[model samples]
Target: MKDTFKHKGLRQQLVNILITKGIRDEKVLNAIGKVPRHLFMDSSFLDHAYQDKAFPIAADQTISQPFTVAFQTELLQVNKTDKVLEIGTGSGYQTAVLCELGVHVYSIERQQELFRKTSNFLPKLGYRAKKLIFGDGYKGLKDEAPFDGIIVTAGAPFVPKPLLSQLKIGGRLVIPVGDAVQVMTLFIRKGAKEFEQHEFGEFRFVPLLEDKN
Candidate 1:
């Protein structure tokens, strides 16, 4: 599996589509352009990798649609060296995007199979999160509390309290909340107990489950 000219071209086209969809963050678009999305998918689905659509990955998970990845990351406003807590490592595509932004990512994945596979796979692609924990995302990484940003890749019925508690003052948390259809939600920590909330339209994602398997 190589990131050839064709793959790079396809990624540029994907970035163009995201721009049309209103993903204006240059950093996000650049990361999307640089990362090889095709390599994240199963070989059989390689041809469809850059289509801006979500495709199934191992462990009953789906690599997020390219736009969704860009959209969430844009909301994060990541800065270099930011400590980011990523819930639901999933296909590790989102994790890779964050890493490309030069943030120190701590991603939590509940499914053991996906966790093990992604933990090994990302480093091979030269993308490494600070810590890829096989634990419940709902609990977050308490010892690493006060992260600069937190992103939940799955749709949660409600925002997890622990996640909010772990955000640093002035940090952002990007997540989708709902069951059938999710509303992209953002929480910005203003102070010790103050948060500013915003919602951005709707999206569909796999449910954010609790506990670890």
Candidate 2:
């Protein structure tokens, strides 16, 4: 239940594993090392927390694998002053990572259970996002649109147009798009109606639900 010395050491090992797997961003590595992933899950799953793999949390959603979190964040290329919107807040692990980078984060969670639990749990750890909205991520945050970066933590069936539309010019939207399996996709908004797209290989994730709350 506490972030002890052993936990911190384990996290450092996880960071080392991530570095070998190609996560080069120092800030991202430090964030991954700093966040106590064990505290994010039930005590029963404590042993699995820093294993660089995803583990189930409440509401059937899994805390993303550490490598995946580092990969998506590295793609965003955001600075401390940037505003990042995170879709699928999940266990708030990713949110905590963004907070470690000192960026303003606005995260959305569709599951009512996760929304309430994470809303309370995250602040207790001192990782307060700009806002944690219990709403549809497919729609993004219109009022808080024009974000410097938007990240979808779940496997969206397809790239939602609104997520792209909400990005500021040159902003990055990192999403995993697929059905049974997902290919990590990145969209960089170059202009009003232009976006550059790139796809990484496959990864698995819980489906990104819509209007489920």
Candidate 3:
């Protein structure tokens, strides 16, 4: 599957960069290595795909850097059969990473343009996510509640309570929480009223807004 991308050198560079930045999970590294980052961006930005930097995609959204994507995925520690929910699907880049990790993914994106584009892009790229929702992700997907894992790509002022509610008892959610400055946080649902919070370092992401666009 990795060979089909035919960018072995680029993948290696990304892997090396990730390793240097402390992403140690081999599974996460492999998934990052396998997904084609270039396919998610415009041709003009193709050259920047391999770099460990976020670049603008359509609709004013930026594809997250390889480092941050791998960092969050590693924190989730997703298992092969787990059902995962992704809060934002900007370029379908993170969705591809989740798919590569072998999760049955349900991703939500509120941008109508990005949603429309990725609906076609993901299938054509042979990446598979179980479902994609074009609605306010702040509400989470109630019908698909209790996911094994949940990832929020955009930063939220407060961790959306409904998203926390949708997590399975033992599920883990990775999100960046803050208003102006954000810190990547992990919430592990231990019970209905109990959760463990683990804080990672800071990160900058687009503000998670409730846009039904």
Candidate 4:
């Protein structure tokens, strides 16, 4: 039997985890169900990949728990025409989920090795992210400015001000913010001169650092 399917039992457990943890968006739940989390990790760890737990993947990075991914995606509230910017494409799992939901995804991975691997894996999954960038995610993507939505997977000490400038009016940015401890924050650009902020709750994530690799 494929280790991937063997991991299916964990999926139900993850659903319960999300429900209990407050990730109640139905679209997020469906996306979690459709995307094959096991395919995003090394085969040796595939059995535990769907267990509502984070696991180290490559380049000293980790794929986030299924709940984190679903919670973040649900926070973004993506629409079909939304152009989404994602920071830290660790295992391409979250990126795949965004793509599955019909967003035009532009994902940035500071780790070169992860970038190469995900650039290759995304197409194979049949969900093509618009671009896979290798650069400092902290700087955000300028040329692709005015994104309709943005999701940052890593924890940041503060929200990147430049990223806020790049968001289109009416766009939403969902990011985890803090030092070692973090809070998932939602930023909404209400208009050219206004924005709204909401603090969700605590979350643990790999730090968002500046790097070319």
Candidate 5:
């Protein structure tokens, strides 16, 4: 529960590394710097928390690498008060980042274990999603439709149609699409029935699963 000065120093170093790696969004970098990533992982991997790497969490999910989180977040172009739907709430680290940027976040997790753990953990860290539900990410929270941005933290075989339909016009959806190797993809809703797609390079993520207990 402690965020020591040492941790703060390490996070600053990480922010510098991100800068060198081409993450120019200062808001995103500041969010990365402020979040105590060590709190998001098992204590066994605490030493690696400040590194720009991903490590295993419970329920066969991996916390996304810091650069990957920043990249997806940057693509969203999140503005303060924007309503964002996060498809996977694996570690709650990415959710905290969005919260830091002052966005209203509704995140869904398919794994009940993770959903419960994160929902309980985040508020303790003073980072809370507006809503965190145990449900299918593919469904995109239909009742909470028209998000200003949608971010899928796991790799999707294809873009979920519900997610696209749930976007407000001019909203962005950032996701990684593929089975084994994913291409970081972005979709901007330009108009009703109109979207603009862009592809960044490849990344590997745990698959975004469907139904779960």
Candidate 6:
């Protein structure tokens, strides 16, 4: 509940690190600088919150690294008023970042514990997504299909076909695909069933879970 000058200074230092690391989207950077990342983390980790790294959160998930979040979001290329689908709404940190950019986010989290936690916690921080559902990320929100962009916050062993099908014709799907280490992949929907693929380097993420409840 406290975002003091010290927190803001640390947040700015984090933003500077992101800039040096090649994250060029001003809006994305601004979003990164705006949302109180420390607030999203447990107080025990408050000291490390602004560091350019991920930390453990509830339900055994990691709030994605600031660089990772900025990178994925930059590739997704969201716009104000755009509809975006997010998989793995773990910490709601990424969710808040997306919201800060003025997009309508519909996020799915398979871990019921996280889903419930984030569902209640996000609005308290003044970041609200269009919908926060407790469900499988593999099964994209069919009811809210054709999103302008989709971001997967966890590591997927393979690209889920449903996620591709849920994008608008020109939409982008930013996901990390692999096992132990994931290659950050971006798929841009082209024609009816066509997509353009590109791969960034590599990053580690908690596994994207399927609904077991």
Off by over 4 Å in 5: none
Ranking by lDDT: 5, 1, 6, 2, 3, 4
lDDT of 4 at 129: 88
Model 1 has an lDDT value of 0.95
Residue pairs with backbone atoms closer than 3 Å in model 1 (clashes): none
Cα TM-score per model: 0.98, 0.98, 0.96, 0.93, 0.99, 0.98
Q: Is candidate 2 or candidate 4 better by lDDT?
A: 2
C-alpha RMSD for every candidate: 0.9, 0.9, 2.0, 2.0, 0.8, 0.8
CA deviation > 4 Å runs, candidate 4:
1-13
- Which pairs clash in model 4? 110-213, 111-213, 112-213
Best by lDDT: 5
TM-score of 2: 0.98
Relative to the true structure, candidate 1 reaches a TM of 0.98
Give all candidates' CA lDDT scores: 0.95, 0.94, 0.91, 0.87, 0.96, 0.94
- The sequence of per-residue lDDT tens digits that candidate 5 reaches over residues 1-213 is 889999999999999999999999999999999999999999999999999999999999999999999999999999999999999999999999999999999999999899999999999999978999999999999998899999999999999999999999999999999999999999999999999999999999999999844
lDDT string for model 4 (77-139, tens) is 998869999999889999988988889999999888998988988898798988999889888
lDDT of 3 by residue, 85-160 (tens): 9999999999999999899999999898999999989998899799998989899999988899999999899999
lDDT value, residue 146 of candidate 4: 91
In model 4, the Cα lDDT at residue 17 comes to 80
Stronger candidate by lDDT (1 vs 4): 1
Candidate 5 accuracy as lDDT: 0.96
lDDT of 1 at 75: 96
Model 6 CA lDDT for position 111: 87
